[model samples]
Target: MKHLCRKVVAGIGIMAMCASMAACGGDTAADGVDDGSEMTVEVFDSLANYQGEQKGWFAKLVKDKFNITLNIVAPNVAGGGSTLFDTRSAAGNLGDIIIMGSGNGQAEDVVKAGLVADISEYIDDTEYLKQYQSAIDELTATANQESGVWGIPTSVSSLAPTESSEGVEPTFGPFVRWDYYKAIGYPEVGTLEDLLPVLKQMQDAAREAEGTDDIYALSLFKDWDGEAMQNGYQFPAFYGYAEGIGYVLSNAAGDDYQSLIDEDGQYVRALKFFNKAYQMGLVDPESTTQNYDTMYSKYKEGKVLFSFWPWLGQAAYNTTDHKEAGQGFMMLDIDDMTIASKGAQPNGTSTFIAIGANAKNKERLVKFVDWLYSPEGIQASGSQTNGAAGLQGLTWDVDEDGQPYLTDFGVKAVSGESVTVPDEYGGGDYTTGASQLNVSTVLNKDIDPNTGVAYNYQMWDSELAKRDTALDVDWQEHMGGARTTMEYLESNDKLAVIPGATYSAPDEDSKISAVRGQVKTSVVNACWQAVFTSSDAEFDQVWADAVANIESLGYDEVYQVDLANSKEMTAARQEVKEQYESQSQE
Candidate 1:
């Protein structure tokens, strides 16, 4: 331990010398220092909040440990983090610490521009980070060799324990109101063709039963669009396509790639289905204009009869009253396709953390980063506590058998019974900082010392036990156990294509990135217009025009690049799989 500490100090010295900005002249001590002086680091990611505002228990822990405050800068819909990143790079105002989501091009661009610190030499020196050398190597393998490792992986958790909820139904898929389905006689849904008709009948039944005129068969929001509207995620999965942020790989085509706008494409077919639904008045008109929050509000009121993601429906459905009333969202085995979340294969790493080359307090920041990857740090960062996922005494407690259990406040917060805590108590909500920790590498293997069960999955059975018969328990029993649906899907060979696990190479990103953006906008607009068209003739016209417009806007170029990249990515994934298999055998 002493030797490792010395190495950590030596590594920090090298980083300080390499830093482009002037050092703080030892305003704070180096590696082993624990002075309580406050240091603020700016962070840019989806988890960003207004500058210097601490939001959750994790943030509070970070402050207490390193005495560092994080000022997170999140992206808006008009211009995502990439746009903000560009502006900041040009102005030299990039955040002190930067985090890039998987497949994002900002990290590559900034690293190439010499804006990120190279922490390569420090990894082996740090006690905690050294354990993840393989993960770091895999993530950085495609990058510039001269630049060294410029980022640390975030959000990479090992597969849950076999006894845990590892391969249960994914959080994404077709979801429906269980009570409404049962009320309407559980119409046959063995095929995609049966789904819409069943939904239409259910919608009518719901309106009649509730005496409400505003119920919708399905609700959608426009906020989550990436390369295509959020529906892009749903439709492609049904078609057995492995989709990344901007590209799609079809299982039928083998290694071939096709964006949604291609000829005879799954996306185009999905649009036609939506068009029929819209014509049948099964879709909410506000879907095109409303945000996620609005859609969530409607979901809570049981106004949405169908949804694409389980979480959207599960949130409101998890409540005591909703469960007892049999009104929450439940999974379905709709015939047309087996819906699945984008495969969560270990991509090595998906998110990256790097400090700005121009950052101050370099030594302190390095130490803080090292501490975050430590075993103790993983628990401090990831687990849920009382009302928040935090430390034991404050947010949780250990049992006589050394099992960590949620405090009453934690149960209330996590179960969505009541998430808000008084400001006078902790001054932050329970949901804050859920993403602040990168537990991807730790969750699978790290058993909370106090909890015999893996901390991540320990709460699963307990949480289910708390739900009434109509909610989680009902859903669990309906599926014949947590893993039953997944096992069935696997046995039937009905799983969707698993996307490649690594981020795309810079060459691929440069070639297709911009065109991919243009194609997305064109596709989204075209899809909506195609859906809203009144007659079959009008639909054909609208669809053709949309396709033509997208093609003109560079759809073909993006598709070609995606095709080439897909083959390479798939091969890389195979290699990683083989390596892991070999390791297991050994």
Candidate 2:
């Protein structure tokens, strides 16, 4: 650790923080002597009012641990925006830590710039590390090799779920307005052929109601988590039908785990279906660039009939709307997950956060992280304590007669539009951080104290159901971070994670990524375009060309790497499976 620190300091080339900045890291761990001072930067991320009125619990924890004052940075970057990242990197005025909201595209850049430390050395030693074996395995597989350790893998237990909710039905289904579905004489959407007509019916309904012919049936956006919620879950659910069990299984029939772009298999079948959908107006034509805010507009404004949306807000909102219009709202699982056209699979947590090299005290930070995952940690970070924003003065402690009594405001909030929650929260006030630490419980609940609305109730409930129903699905999920490299691999987006384990960078990975950029997006898009045209000649030509480029773009070596790594991992997974089976037999 000491040698690595020295190397980092030397590699970073003695451009120590300015005297003023150096003054901030008071008593915090430093490479050199403790100058009896500490440094702090206004760290920022996705959370709103993230500072929690200056004395937030998170802040207090840091302050107590390092004795450094972290004057919480204001103007919290809204929805994982770029203001903080750009500001910090440009001015080199980065804080002691820039906790990225998720391992989106930023992680790649963070690794490449050598701006963070490789906290991997401490992973095996941390008490909580054992609980996060799978995550560590995945992190090791995807991380850049240059920094070796990159960021510390946050052992956030809840966010590290193995599978998501499936609802009452067991098929590849998500929560839709099942009440509305039943009322509408639920159509036969058991196949691609069925979905296309339903999309048409939706388009026609939109045309009749809104008089806009161009308004699409499905609205997909790629920002503000657009692509994820939009295509990531919804499309795959449907796409897997034609693609078959391969979509959910450990490997396609003839392919290895890393062979995502093996066009001869399930993916190609799925792509052809997607191509058909694209041509038949089921998918939004202008969907490639829309953001989340824009995507929700179509749903909220009633522009389309059937679309994928969060059952929680959508159900609550629709119910509220019906009350206003003399009707009620109801949501259902829509019998989709069961009517598998293609496959069934696992859905994990929302996002990933890795520790920054600049984290003032790395070991302490890891301890703090582990503490957060403890029952108490989750409760404190959760809505129970109203976030790490401020002090949590309210409680649901049981009162006389054994009734759980919340504060007066909590009682009054029952009749209000939303539940009223206390402004004061976090920092050892209500003391949820010291409570029960059930990671699974956290995944199953996202209760908002203020609104009294389980905003994530549907998401959680649906995910829970998914978990139960998928007990027999022949599927294994490959989980890791790959956003930036994905964009770089778009033409051939399937080849994004072909490398086994992680890439340390400047060696094989850099080489692979550069070549991938050339053959990714454009090549795949072109092939799909030709296929959609239904021109056999064009399709054949494009397919031939894509295959031809495999060697030229270094895909041959990439494919070989995929084979070697994928076979090993799959074999290991199978061995584990057999071992479990044998143990069960005993």
Candidate 3:
């Protein structure tokens, strides 16, 4: 209901340049006036079904320690939400610091608006920020562009790549519920056909048990679910085209030669599969209207046997308080939802952060930002995940009534003004909850992912590791939808080759989005019809025909653009990796 974009004008930005070939070294320190001037940082940090909130944490710390006053501007009080920040920037009424998400394709807009500083020049300045020369350089090079500095990478986490298990049968590879599958076990359930016979039997079992027949597999969110509505410009690498993080890149080369969707006929195959699932009655009937809570509930109630989700979705079940979710649900990756594993690798083009134009204190904001990247800062933010961190803004053991109990403000609601938390730490700009690690206080108490990892850090990493082993077809290479990728496709035709996509202003961006909004719904509708029917040739044709019309309408040109962008990505990643390897040499 509230938007934070307002008229954000000039403030300090960062710029780092190499001092000399010989690396002169000196750290920059801030000289605080100790004026204790209170700085108000209006942020977006709400946690609800509709609106996101605004917050200031380091601001709280600054307010608590220094003479500076930290005023948090909420949407209700300011008469403006986050989007108002953009509007105010045009009207020249922004705050000192702002929070921006990295995944959205508007970094260029923010940069052009001059709402953020050009910090690119100071990326290598050791005096202002220290201890991560290698990592810092990597961030800079990745954002390198002749056009602008745009945004810097924030948050930090890196883990050693675990050895890929080959001989071990991937736990997710196809399946039949062992209980009902024995009599007619098709022996396996991974490949497309390898799953059919068992699905038919399951359908029969459901019909026989209930007498009133009609069963389905894979659940769908009513209308459009999981961000399918967002990809109004270009379809994403996956099938349903959901947003947020996913495995999309091919490899270091980033060519996308290894595709989940066959370069030529990904849509056709996807449609066919939707039809196949429909005919088999493997999809859940409620999938079309189920929210996440509903779907998980169905799984628990035994309403449907199998469906697709992230590997640790079972963990979300969390049998008891303080107990892990998905602890009991066995992952069956085979027939439920799967795809070719030998596809492109998805890179970390995820959530990022930027300062607000209205931040009350520029110096404080910089200091705060630098602190977050520091080992101490990374440790602080990672703790605020999975309801473990104390109250949102202020986590405490003491309540207002002098009760020695937690006066919680809801974890996600408490904090605000996040810098982009790196994928290595936690996904996106999640700067709350409490560190996912439990440490011995001396070490800032955050998880050090290198050797002695913490619980959540290991949990996420373990989840990523199981990706190869679990193989939910829906999540494999491509599931379905045109979330962010559609937008990327429409605006940046060049990116189809890789490194760069042609740019468009926000107006053009909106028009393209409108076009995609219509197309995507058609896709979901086709899927709804196809999957509802028992697995059959007739149902499969309807699905295929739908894809054919979509392809005829615009997919060919769109896909060509993707090819070009894919090529460019290959070139860009190669250049960066070469530089990263050289810089990482210690």
Candidate 4:
């Protein structure tokens, strides 16, 4: 409800940049000073949903550590909520901080409109940010000519640690309920069809157990529709293509690109599979109407047996009861199912982070953001994920080997078994919650540069192994092969390619931006209609009609732009990868 943007004259901004050690305003601190002001920043990030109480543990932790309170804005698909940028632009009432979605040219658009501040000069003074100079360079090269570093890459592809050295385990692929599969004799599912009968059996068992006839074999949500039922985005991995819903380079040269709309394409096959599930009454009835929240709730209730992503399924059953009974969701190496992990791959763009041009707490907010990327910030925010090491002696403590090990109380806290008790546990909402600042950035390596101690994922696994002997094991004794779905895919060389990482020229963006809405609407409406067709003949007719409609709407023209962009992106990725490799060698 509060606006943090402060209107300042152009002369004042130029003067502030010219001054060496002066604070920008009375309230704003100099470059690295904790102003200790109680600023409520209206944060708009689409990727995260911060629903915690204002005085929750994580929120309080941030406030105490950074001297700022976060006023997280609710998510809105249409124009990013009530504080519309267009309206704010007119009224001069934009929020303090804004995070733009990656790859869609939102950053470029905002910068062109002269809304965000250019922090290029400030970034040079940041200790942690200096390491990402090359990444910043690449970003600037592709960004608007007028705006320099308007949005730093929250998800830095170039700054990611090498695969061997990285501790974060990428989660993507097919997941099934561990309890349900074991009950059904753990039948082999080498193909998509093989999953049907097993799911049917599982659904039937759920119905029988609960005395309810409303169980579903598979659940679906409609929010991800971005130019077709974006479920097609997840389908290509099943056929060995690593990329999701975009042009894939055909050869070693990255000169040629292919679209995913053929009659026999992965998208088509996926739709047909869903249709078959629907005809057999295995699909959730509310799929067309239900949102992600509803689907997730059902997942938590153990009503859905199959999950496309590991995160979705894992969240539902990752509790003390499920863990004690070994009944959580487990990923499987199904035949023909290729798992894809969108690891810290350098997309020339980022889910852009930019400070408002009129931000009152500009200096403090910038310092807070810079701290978020630093080792201290990353650890405090729980970027390590496997071990969210924060609040020493409560959530975790340093061991004799200088590694961070979760205390017994920390384990119970994370596992949702008991309250986390710190040495000085002053109570005000003692619930353990995730930090609101875990944005994508360069992950500082496992060994801390300052302390020369191992932390992050390396230490997390070590401590986990100490507690659970079978912790590292990804599969059950009944299942033979890679430990997790990601491992299986990596071993067999089956990872999906992310289209967003691909490059497109500035002109291409301007051209496609105008036509994207038209193309997406036509494709999604038609494809969804075809998916719900009753008979095989009707499905064929609908599919053909949809294809014809797309062609008539100039789909090929838009696709041509995508093809060129893919080729360019392919070459860009190669160049960036080589640069990183050369740096590592140096």
Candidate 5:
């Protein structure tokens, strides 16, 4: 690997150089290739938000820099299943660029099938990716590659592997409209069940005050579900449990494991909780059929009262106007719950980016992929997903003292406010003009070498200084001056930090994969049915029938495999925890 040419300069210099290069209107690509001829790269991105041609600012950025137009093929928007992937794989091409989950055996499967390219020969030409060589090697090894790099893992962190990934907030927990909760006098919620009555009162108050019929305490969507109902699976994590394997929930401590279908397990309990919400008219009736986008719209309208993730309701509703008005979602403590927090992933997250083996313009494609790992690429493309500040000189910029600050446009854009972008950057609202790939190459919490701070704008010194809005002040006071939700949880010992480790379950054999697929379909269908059941009897019957159906399909055999995998994961996690403890003691 010859690390000769640095395509990007350091820090804000990279942005300045790229902007100047684009302004020059030269016919040469960044890598010195002829740019007179343009190429449209087909991107099969499982995490993409838009399904067709890439547009807006991101399109312009790539076009100017690489002379490439991205044609995104998103399975998420095109039906949300393996159908697209299967069809594409059968046709002898997945796409020029492939982005998908690495944990489900898909990444390894593609490597074995020769669907993706080995980019080891080209890695030396990349500046940023060289720093992530360890991550690339780990992923390739996982794919059983002896001498070639098959993929680059997503969300690679610069932090030590022993540290927790969680920054200011845990990914999952209960977040509710602060104004309504305060209006109700902030009643004590001692348990999961106690949250129901409190939510009901809040919903009633919101409806009466706003004179709207659409208000609901809970709103859910089914688009993200896989082997089980994702919404149902979230509740268990709030109680220090997470999915270890298919149908298996493991506690954060990685000691106990339970089948999701067990009568008394957290999955069923979550279903019952939703059923109770439905009976109390606190759940949105449209929850069953709606997708995430639809549910997000409801959140933007203030129709939904509670969210299981901080990103969801906060991203959609926490605009400057709303926050200033003291009306936005904030973390509400559930005393009995120990929220699960994800630890830092030094080996990167489960998702990965790979190039097709038969991709057109192989060298150019590799160059483009390499750029995605660059600081410039991380800011430009990552702004849409991982909370990186948008393009320097546009959404954000460095001051004379070299401190990063969000511009006026960025201040509005980062907070989910609709702002018109300049025509030079692609004319449109900031949200729509954002990159549609919806995947991140680096973790937002990773420290930028240039800035000496996390890539996330929220952590920037400039952004932090402006956090004293009415909503912030009120929430801080209510939480006893806790600076952030994570601080509040940690102060009260209500958070369970899951250690980050590089362990993954071995890919299931053909027989096990078939059985697992059938089991997944049955479990998902049954879970949804139970949530919408009219009565306790109906819910019980649904669960019983699902168990019987899956068992007949060899559920027990699959469970044994999953159980073995869970045990391995538990051991791996314990090892990481022990290593961290030892380090701290030193």
Candidate 6:
């Protein structure tokens, strides 16, 4: 855990230092610096799990390249609430590096309070960051009204702003255990309601085959819930809608918005779906009390038969051994469902990365941030999450034909196998040793210049040629020879790509904010209660009571404001889409 500070010196001094270090059998740093000054940069990351000094191969990489050490401070892992963030912000400094969401008035509040440094002055000095100038500009305009570059948006894409970023898989939609689904004879799921019977059959088959009474068709958690039951909110995405300002669900095509409590809206429909599942004993009874980690553990244990996102069930269940055995989660077609997907975000994603205004060694911090956007940095830092091949020389390398291919160790590591690293590369478990920053500077599906293919290792020709696992082959065969889920969805016109745009809702006044808080609490509680109701009568009564309770709390006034904001966001998205289309035509 030695932290080093970089120093700028004359070319001759740098040469002398390198010569002296060489004479002493020491190697010069990757960036050609040989300074002895030491420093540790504190990073406040909202998405990270590991806290304290970063370790293993990722630590070694950054230490050698920038001569610095990263000390992570993760509020999510520390206390499971915002206590750490509130205290740190009140103390006048969040951290040297801050990663947070751009929603909920957070980015604006930080900018107005001067908690984050304005990076406009240092951006031009970055070598690789210049390519994302447009993304930075869009974020500045939306968050600060173009006043200054307060923060850089994460996951900026190289694709056109109008194109979806979904490659082989999507972030939303239903995934079922393929083996269980096949056991039930691949019944047609014509609508959301039809899925209940299918899932029940799959669950029964699993229980009978495995001789376990612990299996459930659905497992959910409440820790990630905010304004509403997040699990219920996910259903709307299955039918081409996403949560808008507050209490409203907007279409992915940016054309319409509706109140979440609407009698016929997707949100209510989702609540009914969950209630039916509960009535059939298909839902995990502990869902209301469990956290994400607990629910995920169930998935890993093969006790869950359904998942709402590919990332969740797939990551938990799709081990190499499971796939070879024709067992894993696979996206299932819901005839009435139109999956909501996001297009390439030229304006960047909702997450923001910024430097604290009170941080020391500001110049070095800027250099470090800039490196995160570089190709090499993207490869190394994004390896675990973004599906990028890791650490060029060790995990992957360019072949004789100049195409990137994963090394044998890389294949094993990426496939979730236990592989020991050589001591020179910071030996440890590959997955555990990954960088814990939990943020992406560029989209993984974007093309990598060196390979003429996407940064996702799955998209590489070499990897694709060998990707025919038994589970994959079975799923493809059942889907009429479709190679991937995205392909099947697109061919069937079941995907709705939301055009990317940079927009943040205006800050709510004190009265509106208060009303929103009360209404949200009431709605979220009511929805969860309705799901666990003993009968359909109780479910109906719960909804009626929730509607009356929220109305009494001035829900209508807040709804109007959110509705207006939704319209404004839709208009902004349309404008961005038109601009991209015009540029392409020209």
Candidate 4, residues 416-442, lDDT tens digits: the string is: 454644424434434445565445454
> How many clashes would you count in candidate 3?
138
Q: What tens-digit string does per-residue lDDT give for candidate 3 at 363-428?
A: 555565564444344434433322133222243332354222222232223233344433333324
Top-TM-score structure, candidate number: 6
Candidate 3 vs. true structure, TM-score: 0.57
TM-score per candidate: 0.80, 0.54, 0.57, 0.78, 0.83, 0.88
Ranking of predictions according to TM-score: 6, 5, 1, 4, 3, 2
Tens-digit per-residue lDDT, 441-498, candidate 6: 8888888886788888776788766658999999999888888788888888888888
Q: Residue 146: error of model 3 in Å?
A: 6.9
* lDDT values for all models: 0.60, 0.38, 0.36, 0.58, 0.79, 0.80
- In model 4, state the lDDT of residue 45: 48
Best by lDDT: 6
The global Cα lDDT (0 to 1) of model 4 is: 0.58
Native-vs-model 2 lDDT?
A: 0.38
Ranking by lDDT: 6, 5, 1, 4, 2, 3
Residue-level lDDT tens digits of model 1 in 1-586: 1112122112121222222332222122332453558887887554333344556666666777778887766543223444555555554545677655434344444555555666665566677666666656655654444446677776444442111123344545677887788887766677665788889888999999999979998777787666676675566666566454255645522454666666477676677778788888998999889998998899888788887765577766446777776667777776667543333344345566677666666656767777766545655555342112445554566667655667777656555443655453345666664435323434433344445555553344454355446555555665546533455455555565453256454345554667777888887777777778887789998878877888897787877766666676666656655665676689
TM-score, cand. 1 vs. native? 0.80
Which residue ranges in model 6 land beyond 4 Å of their true spot? 1-36, 80-93, 102-115, 143-148, 358-361, 416-418
